[model samples]
Target: MPHPTPSPREIFASGPLTGHVAVPGDKSISHRALMFSALAVGESRVEGLLEGEDVLATAAALRAMGAQIERGADGIWRINGVGVGGLLQPQGALEMGNSGTSTRLLMGLVASHAITAAFTGDASLTKRPMGRVIEPLSRMGAEFTAYPGGRLPLILRGINPAVPIDYTLPVASAQVKSAVLLAGLNTPGITRVIEPIATRDHSERMLRGFGATVTVEDDAAGKIIAITGEAELRPQRIVVPGDPSSAAFLVVAATIVPGSDIVVENVGLNPTRAGIFTALRMMGADITELNPREVGGEPVADLRVRHAHLRAIEVPAELAPSMIDEYPILFVAAAFAEGRTVARGAHELRVKESDRIAAMAAALGACGVRTEEYEDGLCVQGNGGGAIAGGGTVRTHLDHRIAMSMAIAALNARASITLDDASPIATSYPVFFQSLDLLRGETLVPAA
Candidate 1:
């Protein structure tokens, strides 16, 4: 069982951080590994899976649907799957706690199986718009009874012998794309998705690895992805790489804290997910990719980061999909840079665990950093490695990234920064503060 959420208030006005740390496994990959494994007929072995609450929610949901999942003392997870079209209707609502990815992707899995499953989540997850997935999956013959705006606490009734359609994405969303693909797994004929813009390709790659016939082609309009239905997936031995998203905080902390030298090992540098590193390098941070290799068909590398005088640069709109989850921390990095950093074409940030643009703007302003928020992005003026006034308490609003980002920003602050709730950090990075202590060379003392 996971520990109770602790209301830990971190106060770090620290010096140079010097250490090498390996972050937890990729959360996206961990969820997919468990999901795909549960759809295969035989036993699948997974190592390096993130044990955070979000992935655990996916695991619990799969178990409820009759997959046999177990973890060994050796840290490897084993799953005996129920095969495609073999999911049992869960007896109770699938509780998806703060994980939108699990809820959306699992909705796709349940959308074509001739079963009815109700999905519910924590307060934060229930508020996110599920209409993006609802519209497409509903088109595939699934019936949904959702909240007024297609929010969660919804029930999905799947149809057997579902209809397959070609969908051109209205927005660049990998979750919507993945849900549609997963729904196609049990339907007959080919299910096609025409993406107007590229999102993360983890699902496509992992689906192919599980012996599904998934194809990708570039046309005049964007990439076209097609998956054959009623296909059998083979169980695989998978090793999940370290998540770069989790590594973002450590990397940025090392860069901004001055005189810091650190190596983040075995991080997934998937081209689709390495946009943060590219943006940071463009901002003149001294981050080098060391020992590039491949793990479980994804690119993996060790990142060596050292403190450098950073200059803010305009982040390309095209880079948003690649590093969509990283903007909160990127904003923190920008605050310590030499000039104004502008990020645009990231409207997706508005719909995350919180309205990230608004959350970050308000938090930075509270900490005395100059920031301008936009409908799609932010413009932040750097403090040029100077002391940041940080006596204000930032409201995290149950957002894990916001809490962790503010904690990293506090390293360079003149005063101890406080967060309204750090408990949300357990959603993805449960060992985050422990790792922070390793780098900081002291245990983080929590406020009363």
Candidate 2:
């Protein structure tokens, strides 16, 4: 059979988006919960875990390493761990699909053991540079061989008695930092990391919960994090929080259309991951935090987003590390705000699941938003929260953010906006359309 014409959904919407939405489980936490549970001595239960391909990849890899993990119909996972430093050689390469998180975290899990493993991934993941992770693991005496400049299809020859070291992060990446910390789990002595700029701390927080001696100290320069090697980790039940990245879509949706109010429930409020919310509020978005609570060692809350007039402001480089992944949707939010939104320190976007900086600039420009691309980031000029001129089809580049952002631009656009091949959204957020529909019903938005 011939393939259908590759196209994206044309989403037309105008809203006063008022209602509650439960976002999917936190991807970062879910990955960590599975990995940490695999290293525990006993069975651990996890609820509200993201069953996305990325987390599932971690679970599968752990099961390959002799852990018994299975999902129950009650929406919880039961894991029988192999205990710390108790891993076996897998029969073949552990293919990790498109998750950098899974690949890097798994690299850490494999680095200090007596086992050897190889990993491969999809085209996009294979193309992404793995040197950032390889350098630190190498410093700790793990041998890795990759294609040319350390991309995927990489082999890790583990260190039987790994040598731990004090590693300094050259850049602000939580994945790289977390990989090194996780590798330290089987090594002796102290493994320290100096991060000049802070990234998300989900790994650090969750590691401590698992009984690792993870410490954090703030100073004039930045944050210093240290973990004691060869520590025993005890697994516990995990309640994963709602992903803030997913909530960003509704934050944009309600902001654009006037007279809209939407409540996003159980959102993860980790300060490192809440940068977009800070930026939105600074841009005059109507927002309220309700019933703040804690879940699985992370702060959780409900976000009430109401449609309001927004004005843009200059976003600094220092803030980029915190909100890095949300830039595509943040660019969409900028499209409707008044004045110009400047984002810098965005060179990191070049190496995400896609080249998000270029992707957003191109896709937003297609939707009639005035966007100027920078070497690192972009500046978007808005029409004071007015409807965008939306007659263009956005190329999604197999990026979930690219697809979702274009869809958000369609919400208040004068014409329907089309995003080509939005299927990749399933990779991270499978219920994206469903949540949008639920919010749409409450907003009374008209769509075709």
Candidate 3:
């Protein structure tokens, strides 16, 4: 696979953004749809799948493991699965690119199949901690040979007749939770995961959609999810909703850009992932949920956002799991609000593609926004709805969200904002710049 050359891109201050746009499909759902469908007995069809590099990496890995996946000219992806416990060991290493979700979730799928495989990734993905998934999967009898701290470039050998275990999640991570459930698919008995904090439930929902028996129960302790092992998955047509995480940038851009009125259509509003909208509403953003309905078992809505005077407020800690990926851009929204906005209990941001808290703090500070970084979060002082001084360039550190967030911040900037290494944006939202151009009502020619 060829990699796009990293280059600096500039986003200039624009007038009010006005348009109806749809972002790419939900990345989380896209990944699971591909994985689950690949494990089914027959051909599964998926529409509106995110064709970004991250999801493509998952598709490629599955194909390498004997799943027949193809994309038709009609824009639908069809996959012929190898069924449960039928995956063949790949001839070589699986190149996961920039997707931690792909690497972790696929590890779970590979953990009980009696196959040996090596997983490797780019510099950024190599550094992300895999131990979270490793420890739990290891308990299921899978053996791993990894770098120190459970980093990537590792080999995993699955144990036939792997033991099923009931494990409690030490952290609030959907990836870890999904990995355990996926691993349980081939075990002899039930594999249970008790999550102390609720994360995204796409895996449970989609698994059940694919004919897997997954049960979720809630108690004072938290969410208890149990999956039966050696279960057969049924293939079905899936329509993925627009990603709320990808829509966050559009929502925030519309809210902060003066006279802006835009509708983001068909966005997934699963309660687990709508915290960004809730947080923005709490900050007095004028956002309305329209045409509420369901798509592929997940709630979908068209969001209408208008320019409003935003006031900074302390974000609730419990909402962190729901909106973990939105903080970098929420920090951008906070920069345009009045007074100070405080966000905490999001130490997870520290372990994302970049140290988002530190990365956003440094980037915002460079753009003349007052921000204070903390161990868990940040306190941002708003410029009181004034134009932000954004002449400085921001280093993206190969994090897609950071690059896009800074681009949203540039809408209200006093000068053009330059971003270093915007190539990573292709990992999740390949048409992000095109969407920006549409909303801005002009072509944004990147400086060579």
Candidate 4:
């Protein structure tokens, strides 16, 4: 089998970056567009969808389920949905690759159908616990057969006459909630999910945008999200906004290192997903949000960032769910702060592609920042976002965030910081290093 490779490139401090660049579409939204399009009737057209490997897995799975998808001459993505409760038995197992979002969400979609589908993935995806999505989905009458450890290579045997149930989430997982709700789509009543902590609302928001009946209410108990089951999903055009997660590296890179000024255009500023930007602002980052608008039912904005004097603030635990994946880059920003920034309620990091808490602590310390490793989070003392001690080979453990975070860590170090196995960065941000390199080339001397 053939594979892809990410060229190893070294990052260095370049003269103040001053330019604008457009990021690709949001991966989370891209994944949902593909999946929801498959569920909606008729042809669903999507513009600005992400072309990264993870989102592509969703596209592939939809195709396997009998949806006809094509890329238009104008570069727009168009899909012919199979309609809710209209999927046919696929010829082969769904190979989800390395995407946890695709694997878990598909479980829900397959659960309420009168079909049996097998699921498998790459090593990283396989090792992840599927029981979270499995538990809630099972309560909705989905029967799952899996390995003794509850791992992948599992077969999900659907109960077509599925029963809709009200399930309050045990954790703040958008994937789990989405799985149950998707399963409920083929059942007979209202399917309710109560979440104590709000995760990303992309699923709920997009569901409504696609014409599904979804109502969200908040109270003392938490947020109760209800969806009317056994309904029709209307097909509509979707225009995905730029990804903020991909923009985090550039945003932090331009802010911490002196003389760097950049304009990141068309980035998604969805309130639920932009908490990291808020934290950076609290740290005195000279970031300005501009050109705010809406696309595909999500908020979009342009960001201008300049290097500024920095101070650290205690990060609230409640903000964890919004910016969870951006923590590695936050560590990069924290390394440059003037004081200590304490992050807690991050037990979720331990279960990610790598144990991010341990990885960030060990890497930051190797680069001369004082770091205290906690079971769930970390305490990072600052070097004032300036040139600090930098001499270490940080292991990425096949995690893209760790690899990119370490690359940004290079700007402040006295010596180059080497990162191991940056190949996986292509999973989400394929053009990341290239975009950074293009800006660097504009500022530096021609290579001999």
Candidate 5:
């Protein structure tokens, strides 16, 4: 359950954080597993689904659209799918909560069905631009009526046997690509999407796992992805790997806090999403992979991270698409490094739950860390592992990553740090605070 009201938290500098832990399942895979399962004709069982607010919101929307989703006492999520082209019109507005992923991907599912649904979300999600997904879905013959600027609280009416268009990604966005792919599920012909820059391929991988004919070819422009529509899917038993994005917070906490040693087990190491680890190792963090293997068609590993004296390096702009969700915490890591760290080609941060580049710059400045903001990225002046001047409250702008990143910053700060609202953390990692407490080997007593 998420905190209904604002929940502020004050974090004091603590001793070495140490523990062996497992983060929640991959949020992206969890969302896809549920969705693809709901499109299969039979029962699909999912283990290790992230039971966060965002995912729960997806489940609720699916239920309204004729999917029978339930969580057993044993914690396995069982889904009975309505099959391709079988989704019913939702009875009421689909409340997306704060999940842009759910909002976008589900719109694709509805685009090829003869259904009408109204989409709505919380204040934070309502502000996010849906135009990226709407453009393609509209081209697939789905009609939309949205707020000004393509914001949420919108209406969409699907057309059966929708027209499939050959689309090219205007930007490197996995959500937009996935929305178009999902729309192709019930479409009549081969729907094509040419991506100039590759994003995460979870949707393509999961679609293949469910027996869809999704093909990819490399060309000069980038990868050309084509999906054959009106495909039948088979239900599957899926075990979601741990989220590398969630593991990032713990990885950085252990790397920057002196004397800290921790292990986060079962983290997904999909090449498309492992750029953060690459960037951290480039900056000289001691991270080792243990027992590398595959789970549910994705790479999995145990990550052992120890505190190391880090030196700053320029993060490659090419890695932006792979680890876009992790830049906030990466910024925190840069603050403790030996030299200036610069990140560019990540303008996507501006359209997230908040303007992450601007938010992180302002938040770090409040804690006495120097940072230069750019239109596309940020440059952080590192302190060479010295204690940071903290003792300030950070405004999270209802972004979970912002709140969690600031909490990690407090581990090496000279004084306590306060978060204006920690409640947003529940959207992705509901047990983030609990994991922090476990790694720090102490209970966190938030200030009143």
Candidate 6:
């Protein structure tokens, strides 16, 4: 598929943002649902799957490996899985686009099967270090040939009856944890991962949902997750909740924009993924959960967020794993807060789609927000809920989160905020601008 062209857009200061809006389905869950469904024995149906390019890349890779996947007129995706240990070798290299999640997780799926495949991606993805995954996967008997520094454009040769080993994470990474668990699915005996710091547990939860035997035990180390390999997975009807990561932009925008009141519906409030909400509430954001319930084994809620006098607070380091992708937007919210918001223990931000720490510092500085950047985190001095001086252009560096976060900052700015290129937004939230327009009740014009 051809990518969207680079488009320069400007977001002007708007009146109170008010609307009941829903973001796309959880991108992480959407990717897992497709992969798990494709590994089951029968047909599985998924509703509310995120159709963004990142998730689509996962679907295409699964299809190439023999899963029959298609979308129905009702907007539900149907898949016929090839069963555990049944994936076929793709005829050519799998184009991963800009998704590190798809690239890494899919690498795990291919590691234990008896097949050889090549993986490649766009510029940003190719720059990320894959050695974190390679370390554990190699211990599991998979052979790899990667570029220097474990970059992409790598060839992986799978080993049937692969050796399953107990591995400990050197750092907290959901993608790495999920990758190890996925590789264990086709291996013999039990595959175990001992995480010293917990990450998202989507793989373990979804694994059990599909009838796989997954056990988790907490010890002095952290979360010990074990998956029994060669287990038969049953097809499931999955309903993906709204992405908390995507909902984050709306939540922060609502809190920082004066008089803004909105309800973001059906958002996933999984404890492991709700750190952004926790952090914002600590900053005195006026957010209330309505009709809280469970959807597809994850908690879901309608967030009624209204403008409040937000006060800056220290963001705890332990919350990093849960809201790793949300810090960029939180930084934006901090710029309009009452004092300095200190965020630390998030060194993982450096290895994301962009070096988020440095990127947010530079972007916020361009808009006249005082910030101190560190290797691990950033400290933003809030303006006591005042409008930001947003005359400068923000260099997005092709990160979707940076692009969207800066757009939200413009809502309370004295001048328009210019994005160097908003095309990268399509990788995750394709309709972000549309959602913004709906909330602001205005059509945003391009930056001249």
Any residue pairs clashing in model 4, and if so which? 16-259, 336-385
TM-score for every candidate vs. truth? Answer: 0.98, 0.95, 0.99, 0.95, 0.99, 0.99
Best by lDDT: 5
Q: Put down candidate 4 lDDT per residue, 42-92, tens digits, no spaces.
A: 999999988888898888888988999898999899999988898778789
What are the lDDT scores of the predictions, listed in order? 0.94, 0.86, 0.94, 0.84, 0.95, 0.94
RMSD of each: 1.5, 2.7, 1.0, 2.3, 1.2, 1.0
Candidate 1 off by > 4 Å: 1-6
**Quick one: how many clashes does candidate 1 have?**
0
Clashes of each: 0, 5, 0, 2, 0, 0
Residue 78 displacement in candidate 1 (angstroms): 0.2
Q: What is the lDDT of residue 53 in candidate 3?
A: 92
TM-score of candidate 6 to 2 decimals: 0.99
Please provide, for model 1 over 1-448, each residue's C-alpha lDDT reduced to its tens digit, 9 standing for 90 to 100: 2234658595768888898999999999999999999999999999999999999999999999999999999999999999999999899999999999999999999999999999998888888999999999989999999988999899999999899989999999999999999999999999999998899999999999999999999999999999999999999999999999999999999999978999999999999899999999999989999999999999999999999888989999999999999999999999999899999999999999999999999999999999988899999999887768888799998899999999999999988899888988988999999888898898888788
Please give the distance, in angstroms, between residue 315's alpha carbon in candidate 4 and its true position after superposition.
0.7
lDDT of 3 by residue, 218-333 (tens): 97888899999999999999999999999999999998989999999999999999999999999999999999999999999999999999999999999999999999999999
State residue 376's C-alpha deviation in candidate 4, in Å: 1.6
The ten-residue window of minimal lDDT in model 2 covers 1-10
Residue by residue across 110-155, what tens digits does model 6's lDDT show? 9999899999988888888999999999999999999999999899
Residue range 65-160, candidate 2, lDDT tens digits: 999999999999999899889989999889888789999989998999989999998766887889999999998889999988799889999886
Cα displacement (angstroms), candidate 6, residue 375, comes to 1.1
Worst 10 residues of 6 by lDDT: 1-10
Candidate 5 lDDT by residue in tens digits, 350-372: 99999999999999999999999
What's the distance in Å from true for residue 305, model 5? 0.3
